[model samples]
Target: MKSALSAIVLLSLAAPAAAQTPSDWRTPDPENILVVETNKGRIIVEMEPNVAPAHVERYRTLARKGFYDGLEFFRVIEGFMDQTGDPQNNGTGGSDLPDLEAEFPFRRGASVPFVEAAKLPADNAVPQATEVGFVGVVPVRSAPSMQMMISVDGKAPAWGLFCQGVMGAARSNNPNSANSQFFFMRGPYASLDGQYTAWGRVISGQDVVVAIKTGEPVAPPRDVMKSVKVLADIPAAQRPKIQVMDTRGPAFKALIDKARGADGRVDPCAIEIPAKIG
Candidate 1:
């Protein structure tokens, strides 16, 4: 009896750590994953509707209709991102769906609006008129649309930080022009913020993204999106389970706090330790 009890205790101690590994990882909802096949390679992006529901829904809608298949990367800048999702395969194509309205307000130093009802209303509330800066208002009747641009340089706008492997929609010069073309950030770049509508990020297979070859120099260069498919189209149990670190959770705050000491001094070596430990 004592030996059996000891075995149970040992199992209890080992269970959680075993579950934390990949074997116990939960697969993302099929509806949430996008399989983008590029000429260079395939990129699987996990959509964060929690972050940008309108934009994510639009992308899913387009993907279901087979709108992104056969599209070319169209634009590739080394150390930057590989851009695709153009139905025209020329960096200028969209779905049959009409353009969507811009969701986040274009402002400096502001966050991407939260999705909760209380948060949404508060975000939509008019900022003090005096606080308005370079406002570009579109007619209220327009559909909510977004574009994709991968960061290649420093951080650009305040909407979202351009990290490695972000997925976004593409658009023309018009704020409402994003229809089908999208891009992935290969690296970090800040200059693209206000100019692009960021919708999602890559949750896995980032190595595939980094391996894509660049296109030739031309008026409108071309990389390739070999194909694009929704995860639902694939059989269940074959998909990989990816768990994102909860940015809003205490774990994240603790990480950030440790990055910049209480005095707000950043020690680069401190940041490296976590990656090494992981």
Candidate 2:
């Protein structure tokens, strides 16, 4: 079966220019782009400040300081996530920076652009929230009424989904204990939906993430992030220009229409709108 993207991208391939134009795509900002190179390959992450600004800032600070370079994935749990960024190379370590207050377990109002595209009032199949959609390319789950109960800056409550490649902070039992340690989701974990703060997601090179060396938690001789740099930190000539399929664009609309036309509901995860990097 053709993925929703495969079907639309095939049509886009026939009309390359229309699909390649600026309006149809969004180039991630250098400051917001994270470039991670492991022994396996490069993985690109697009930071989302809208959802968890503090966590994003912490990540940016750590990345700029080269805090993550040479750090091993100290904890890799199969079917859960790959945890890293601990300077001590174990789950016990953290950066000099202070721990961030929990930004979630609260409402993020529905003012986000993608929430509108979610067709919220119609029906959302997501069990975790009344509405579900993408914030850019990052999947999010939220409740419209919860957003209404309490909203910040006209935005409603929405939590980034713990789907494949979702980047989130690894906290102690305390919700606010999140510091430098973070994890990349290897698969879906709906149980984590509203509890953690997800600052970004892998836009490409996810295969490398799936290939991350896995063993017992706290195991040694595991895979490591050989070098981690912000796309802006890298030489301009060497940086990759990443463009995500415009959720607001007609191409995405057609894709959704096709998917919804055939199936009463669309699996948001199955839509597969990947970023195009050049």
Candidate 3:
């Protein structure tokens, strides 16, 4: 099923060349940024703590401990995803931390910086009709604010979408088993939406994520992440100055408009949020 949509997914994420003034870019919080130096190249990820707080905290704790360095991409599939973060280098190891509960179906309050792309009808899976859009660089499906009026809490439920470049926690059949292993999506896969915890999205290096050598077992000499560090942890002189297109700004609004299809609905995964690293 996924293979059939591979071509379309790739094409949809193709960002048009846009020259933006310096004001269009915004610097991400260093604490929420990750610099993944892989054998292929540097990949920058902007994590959304608001979406999956526990998952984001776990990544930060493990990264600060240097637990992610030297881990290899053990399971990579073309047009799918790249799974890594196993100390055993074969997907059977994790940090000693206890497992975490699933973080999806989070609450999306009115204050969240959500840029709506399209509205979706309610379904069995999501009882409330939802609006799909980008909350910063992360694609999300959220119940409309109207749902908040009668709710016990004042916020509506929302979850991250498994869009291209999204980051998801790898878990066993048990939904809460995610510990240290995670994957970076190579293409959009909606099936994983409520199944795994999505904590962030790659703001840069979608090319390098897809360029990872593809294999279920990824034979010897598999690509490795040489170092994974929180941006704030890197030395001031050594850190790569980074900026992502402001999702709330007109430039990103234009990008969102450009991604809309004939039906005027945007494929959350089809967007390639632009970034710059200096």
Candidate 4:
């Protein structure tokens, strides 16, 4: 009986380990990553090739061609985000490339779906849960354009969370106005969803984003991108190598489980592992 009980304990301990799934984690294509250098500091972002292949490719082409070398962060909203990517530095500049069809419905997880609302939701009416077996929305084939932004807040139903250092595409008053000008999420703000197109997320240098000075009473806040360069432009031998956590892996699931309780509220740190980069 003692030996049987010991075997059961051993099996229990091994259950989670056995269930752990190894993922084919690959580095972002050098062409698909951007290194945005701001006066505050630098941010490293990985474009979602799976979600917006055309935009990602176009951005890579533009960056490699020196299109974003000296742009400024023209719009800085305090406690929100810093917007930039205007080649003209006048809040309205873009590449010679024609406007591309919007790509919507990129899957991050079970939380959100990317797409435009053909019809607005009814007042006080919550949409039904999305049906299972839904793959994600895809973009129409058309011309390619380059623009992006970053998020710094919680997740949205139709948009990426405004997490620190996230990158997204800049747009005009119209939803399709995003051309080349973009923004970076400086802080948490959920209201911008459906108002902007989220195209990428920063993988590093979030501390630089936190340190940016907030916009003040007198002038438009400034957290300018000193330079935006594609990793391909840098010599292979000199580029920084980073490994991102696989969001779909068992480790990530364990992390999410540990961060929140049965009720969804995050537990105090005393009972949880420090949620810092491992």
lDDT (tens digit, per residue) of candidate 4 on 1-278 = 00010000000112234234435133556677788787877777777665555667767777777778766655555556666566765565687887654544332332333322122222332243221110121111111111111223332223333344445566655555556666666654445533445566656665665565554211445556667788777887878774443444455346435545455533111111111111
Error of 1 at 111 (Å): 14
**lDDT tens digits by residue: candidate 1, 1-278:** 00010000000112222134443333456788787766665566767554456788988888887777666655666767766665555555567778766544332222332211011111233331111111110001111212113333311222443446656556665666666666677765545543456666665555667776665322444556666778888666764444443333343334435556455543221221110000
Q: Pick the candidate with the highest lDDT.
A: 3
RMSD of 2: 6.6
lDDT score for residue 86 of model 3 = 83
**Which is better, 3 or 4, measured by TM-score?**
3
Q: Which scores greater on TM-score, model 1 or model 3?
A: 3
Q: Which residues of candidate 1, in runs, are more than 4 Å off?
A: 1-27, 39-41, 106-158, 216-223, 261-278
TM-score per candidate, in order? 0.62, 0.83, 0.90, 0.65
lDDT of 1: 0.47
Error of 1 at 248 (Å): 3.8
Q: How far is 50's C-alpha from truth in model 3 (Å)?
A: 1.1
Total clashes in model 4, counting residue pairs 3 or more apart in sequence or in different chains: 16
List lDDT for all candidates, in order: 0.47, 0.70, 0.81, 0.48
Q: How accurate locally is residue 221 in candidate 2, as Cα lDDT from 0 to 100?
A: 68
Query: What overall lDDT, based on C-alpha atoms, would model 4 receive against the true structure?
Result: 0.48
| Candidate number achieving the greatest TM-score relative to the actual structure | 3
> In candidate 3, what are the lDDT values of residues 126-204, reduced to their tens digit?
7767899878788888888788787887888888888788898888877778889889989888888877778898877
From the highest lDDT down, the ranking of the candidates is 3, 2, 4, 1
